[model samples]
Target: MASREFLKILSSARLGDVLAQQKLAEAYLTGAYKTPIQPANALIWLEKSYFSVTNQELKDKQTSSNSTTEILTQIARIPLAQTFQSPAFGFGWTSFWQLAHTKAETQLHLAAKWQLANLLINPDHQEIQAQLMEFLKGKNISSSLEAIAGLDLKGLQKIAKQFLQELAETDSPFTSAAKELLIKLQPKNAALSSLWISWLDDKNEEALLQAAELGLTMARLTLGLRLAQLDGGDTKSNASLKKAAYWLELAAKDGDRDAWYALGEIYRRPQFSGYSAAESDRCFDRAADLGHAEAQLRKGANLWRKREKSDEKVRGLQASYWVWQAHQQGIAEAKELLGKILESCPDPQKNDWHELALQAEQAINHHVEHQLDEDWLLLCHRIVIANQFHFSKAELLLCEVGQLQHEHCVVVDIRWELPKILPRLIQIETIQQRRALLAAGKVFASSDLEIEGNLRQRRYRFDRVTHWLTTTFAKANKHQTNTELA
Candidate 1:
């Protein structure tokens, strides 16, 4: 018989008690309290009980066919069928594919499953190995047994081919996943074959640039690094650095703080013949504005590096803010600086550095669990508050971030842009017989920016912006949701 206490705990858990639910699940899983082994009973009870329990969502709202139909009905009532009708269905494996590419690890199991399928279909592909390696290297870890799984004869043959190629090029015999796979594939040949080194020469600038422009973030970082090296001072030195800086700027604009550090280096040298510290400071400030942890630390150090002691001292609070942000991002130098700053100030609660430090730490933890920080929300609020100003790009970003937050940061004013507006007009005009001139090109987002009747007007379209935001945040949401279910 189940103990009275365990039964009470399970009942409470079903009534929305998370801790109780966890305890009950653990008890059942472990066969505690002299319970007989009962996987079937445990699975059934846990599934039903957990579904009934109230829980916070960290992912996008999952759509069952039933729920999706209901949501579409409610949306139709808003008199904006065009806006309400979406192209893609709710979270599915395709969505999972898009998210795993972005390294948003809210749903490890789902991501792993998607990755497995991808590898299976395109076995022995170099691009796949490279992508996996890049993701792993960023995390400072190696070896993903989950990435390579048991397959049938055909699959194994394909895997063997791919594994041999990877091992041939990889340097470290034991540590390199590719090298290890090669051993498994061809034990005799593996010892005799020369290690592969030509893959390093696979840098294609045009492809990299194209990927960066399309918002493949790793591509942006890679392009930036390659440009930073100036790689033996080729004839294309200035062009290389400038292009690198531009891409880095875009990355920084997209909330990448490390890009700012790279920006600082590019702008630091007069010999590089680029922007000055003051000019670079703008980029750094922009980076800091977006919570780039290391960017914050470097901006502070940049002040001291330039011998701008007065400015540095005056901006101590701001510097400390970035320092704390850096510390939160795991920058060792920033952490040491923050420690020294805190020791000198000795304030219990109100120290600016201390407060910012706490906020930064909280922000990282929130991000890890697929939650947006309040600071990001405030930035979105600033955009919304500018309803009169109407920067469509800013509005689009708000909507994008809101995907994870579930309309938390969405501003209602996004309906004003020409890109968004033109579509609505087309839908309505089809209902009414509109003139050909009225339909000619009908003000598009790329139409123009102009002043109209005392309101500052700009042509904005949410098409690309909306798609980008949805693709990115939907993935994040799905990841979190899958994690919860797992």
Candidate 2:
């Protein structure tokens, strides 16, 4: 119910008032009074005030609260010359017509009347098409037709096409809205059309399953897809159909990549109770090419598991490729796995392996801080350092590195004392050069160095302490002198 004050405002608003027009437009646009203020009525009065003799300041009042560009465009398109003349102009011409085809219907009637009048006056069928063709010569009617091809009728289609051609370059959402409105106005086939749309807004698996059994293509596709994904050894009774394989195969053949992927997975990964690896690989291979990333990863992993060197090399490369693609697209696990593989590999570097290693480390840190996936943190640390240096080197310096950790340390026997002469052989260069040598498991070998001096008994401790100080002091002095010169 509107307040007495609102009703009083409306009564005053009807008498050619600009403030009233603005207020009424707001009320209608927002449903201010809970009184079902019709937009059509509000638009008519607002448009009237917009074009009439009124104070510029009052008439130009526009709100920024809501901006539906399509609605504004449609409102702007209405001709002011013939609007609100009388009921004869049309039945209730207003903003409500923007939501329906009535306004277009009225315009169509007018256009038809002009065409009919011209035809009656001239009465030449050949001349009519020739004149129409001449009028539309430069106009690209095909593009216009394509835009409104969704509309049902020839007349509205023609008009919409022409309108689109005129506004081809304009930024408007009206074409979509107009096309939707045209669909609403279309005549329907009452029988088959009743069940044309299938909605599933709630969780009712049984209903979906039953529908699928009854031969609804969508339902069959859904259920067959799901059944194909069940772990290989479930009870036979729950298999849904003895022809389960048949329907799933059919769904896959029908361009359902998910179904194809699912079918491939089933055939490839059958349990002791159920498929063979060879069968599963074939399915996975097909699905992978059909743009299924999971299938590609699965196929690659499966191929690597077979221990066939040629296949292992191919699959590892492909697995890395597909996983990297997925990782770049924001899949976190793919990113982590790719990082690990890149770090572990010894030969040709296909990507920035170190960057990926850091990515894995940072991601693991984030996860660990949130207590989300603590396992990845340790794994990330191990892989990153291992990739930066040799495995033994990384393991030995694992304590020095802040983020990476191992589950446990195992001592491996060395046959003889490490050559202390090796450090003297290569002059200590960059900090990174020293780090690289140390990480390659040199620390473990260096532990055996014999200190033949006054510090002989505490040789192990003395040598390590001396080495640490010399490396640290040397790097610090180099950096300091460079800084001082600068």
Candidate 3:
């Protein structure tokens, strides 16, 4: 039986209100406000609460310069930002900064999980013991034990692991913390020890199978690839490949590029009875997207081969983009193919390339709008990205933040704003270009569209901002021309 106010809070929770959800979860867990004690229902709301909190944090950070600096710092640290990671790492590191804010109550949600992870790894950790005691005492004072359990022991570990895993994937201090806890959480079994030895020698089939079953992604990948490469004439080859595909598919879902490439190879093996070119190509495409260099070359060649006659320019642009990526990674074959590609695919620039966005951003120093109006601030960010991407005025004004992004390009289609204007795909060529795109996309995704207005209204707003930018650039150019003439 629920009270009217309790049902109202539940309604708000269902509508994605994090604070409301947290409140309901607390009330349910502790039997607060005469609500029935139900740890399972509490876990349900708590999960929703954390996820919603994350979404809200992102939305809030969209307008913060602190967030921008943090994001840029993270992106600039990636090992292969230029070729392998155009925009993929851009999205990942941007998501790294999670909910660590001034709100003490909301933070307890994460703190509790962090302590639980610590305690899971070291059951006698005195610091964690103190922290957990403080947490349970602070939040409604009882039945926090049931809240952790979600009414079962396995459920508690799953929740803790999931929480830590999400933290580990990001580029925050929590990432290392989450990773350390997760590593220790793995069972200290004979199978795991055997799997460690197999990494170097790889002869122990029984050891590999046990570790793969225990959910080690690298073990699955190693075993699957080893199985995939077995002689096709073996009587068990078909079954081995089938089993290889199964394990490789699981590893691929975990974002292992090697697993994706192996799956591609297995599917394309001519001797395999269940061979499917379409499926093989799909796997290769995914592998290429994940930054496997050889897969990029294969994907590029495949695209070149299947290019549509009518849409040659578009298809060729797309193909050459992948081929160009492979060429950059010292692929000799890709370099030869790129020579052919360049004949059909003209260079993307008419003028020598300049990072004018970086210069313009420095000149304007427009981040101040963060203190003024968040919408205006994001508009400034979008303008910087548009300049970086070499967007035309119309494209800059009309492009949807999220829709235009591709692996190698941003699709700028503004026919909805001006039917006479055609759409185009602009290449994302630099780490800086990817950085700009991530910045704009991060902000604009959370902006209020109705407040931003219709296309015509947006155009007027763009024109207003465009005036100052043009004036500044024109002045700079005129000065340069005079200096050159002298």
Give the per-residue lDDT digits (tens) of candidate 2, residues 1-486. 787766866887788665666566567656776656455565665665554433343433353212232233334433322233332122223232232333443433333322222222222333433443323333433224343323333443355444433322333444333333333333454422333233265646766665543334455566665554455545433344324556666556546666666666556443422366666566667777776767756654554344345533122444555554445446566655665434333321332345444444444446645463332333444344444443443232222233122211112111123322111011122344234333433322433322222223334433453354345345655787899999
Query: Whose TM-score is higher: candidate 1's or candidate 2's?
Result: 2
Give the alpha carbon lDDT tens digit for every residue of 1-486 in model 3. Answer: 788889999899889876687678678657877998654455556556544545554646655445343333322222211111122322321222232222432333344445444443344454543344344344433242334322233454465566677667756555666765565467777768777588568677787787776668888887787778643434346778898898898789779998998888887777677799889888888999999888999988877887766365345667778887887888889978876654321222332223444434643464564243565555566667666666666666677777767776666667776878765656566777677678677777777656667768777776665565557566777788899999
Best-to-worst ranking by TM-score: 3, 2, 1
Residues 1-486, candidate 1: write the lDDT tens digits.
Answer: 879888788789777664565556456556777666543344434434334432444244453333333322222122111111122111121222333344432333233222333343333544544444344344433222233233333553364354345334534321234333333344333312222111125555565665554455566776786777734454346667788888787676556767876787678655566859776777677777777765678776654344445553223444455565677678888866765443231232433233222333333345546464333423323222222122244343332222211110111233343335311000111111122112211322223322111123211322332243355555666787899999
TM-score of every model versus the real structure = 0.27, 0.28, 0.39
Summing lDDT over every window of 10 consecutive residues in candidate 1, give the lowest-scoring window: 423-432
Clashing pairs in 3: none
Clashing pairs in 1: 59-477, 60-477, 168-196, 169-196
lDDT of 1 at 254: 54
- At residue 85, candidate 2 shows an lDDT of 34
Off by over 4 Å in 1: 1-206, 213-215, 230-236, 302-315, 344-486
Clashes of each: 4, 4, 0
Q: Which ranges of candidate 2 are over 4 A from the true structure?
A: 1-199, 202-218, 226-241, 268-274, 311-315, 326-337, 344-486
Candidate 3 local Cα displacement, residue 158, angstroms: 11
Judge candidate 3 against the unseen true structure and give its global Cα lDDT, from 0 to 1: 0.62
